[model samples]
Target: MPRYNMYYPDYEKLYPGIEKRPDILRVLRASDRKMRYMEKGLKLERSVWDRKKQTIASLPSREISLEELMEDGRQQFSNGPTLDEQVQHQEELRHLHQALCSLEREYQLLLYFRYWKDMSQEDVAKMLSLTQQAVSYRERYALQRLKDFVQNGEKKKF
Candidate 1:
């Protein structure tokens, strides 16, 4: 009664309300253990945001650079979802983006490298300076976190 071959992000999106099988949970837990470094990445991003805000505050009197202002506006304008793709693509994108925001960097990188870049576990281990076993553990942990977050988030919807 355990889930197999279940990607956390995909499962979370597809079945936010359903309970996960114990087998799936085991896989996710394994991935999460290897990818704990992602927590550090999230902290780093927060620090960056804090520093940027402080710098902007200090430069209040200075005129905003035109290019920076334009870029900001462009970013804001492009933030909305596009309507061209099929419904499934849009949902997948939405779920992925949500997962990206909620999960740690290690999880994101694992997913990107494995699914997007089509990298093998051995290659990932070499790149991450970890053993294959370690990498696999982190991946499972990250996926589990994603599943839990999604399931919990959905619970709040009702």
Candidate 2:
């Protein structure tokens, strides 16, 4: 446990658990992570107090400056749930893989040629030896069905 002297220059300012006392904290224990997190708001001064006299002294409290720490990128509370988001993206890819696998061979080929191969409708028609109109209609219908299937599968939570 390390002691910290809370230096609030504005004596009129309000802070809990310290309003009635001489602003200096006798003993404060913060975890290593939390200590690091609050590093900017902490301060060290050799002459801030006289331990033998049990009296308060002076040192600026600049430990854990919000603006500085935020810029420095050491704030734990600032982190987002990126791990959860990455897991969610992987899960969606797995679901799409399964959905694609369940599609008919012709529909899968249509999608692969149009999207995966990045071919135009006319090119896809030429590759499949079908009319462009027929290719367009079937591709649109298949994509609609794929979207519906994916949405329904997501609703099922499986």
Q: Number of backbone collisions per candidate, in order? A: 14, 5
Give candidate 2's TM-score: 0.50
Q: Assess each prediction's global lDDT (C-alpha) against the native.
A: 0.63, 0.69
What candidate 2 gets wrong by more than 4 Å, as runs, is 1-62, 70-81, 154-158
Instruction: Report the CA-based lDDT of candidate 2 relative to the real structure.
Output: 0.69
Per residue, candidate 2 scores C-alpha lDDT tens digits across 8-106 of 233324446574665353222234335565654456644566789998887655444677667887674735668889899999898888777767788
lDDT of 1 by residue, 48-132 (tens): 2356556432224334444556867744245544666567687767875676677667778887897789999889999988899
Worst 10 residues of 1 by lDDT: 39-48
**lDDT, candidate 1, residue 22?**
62
Best by TM-score: 2
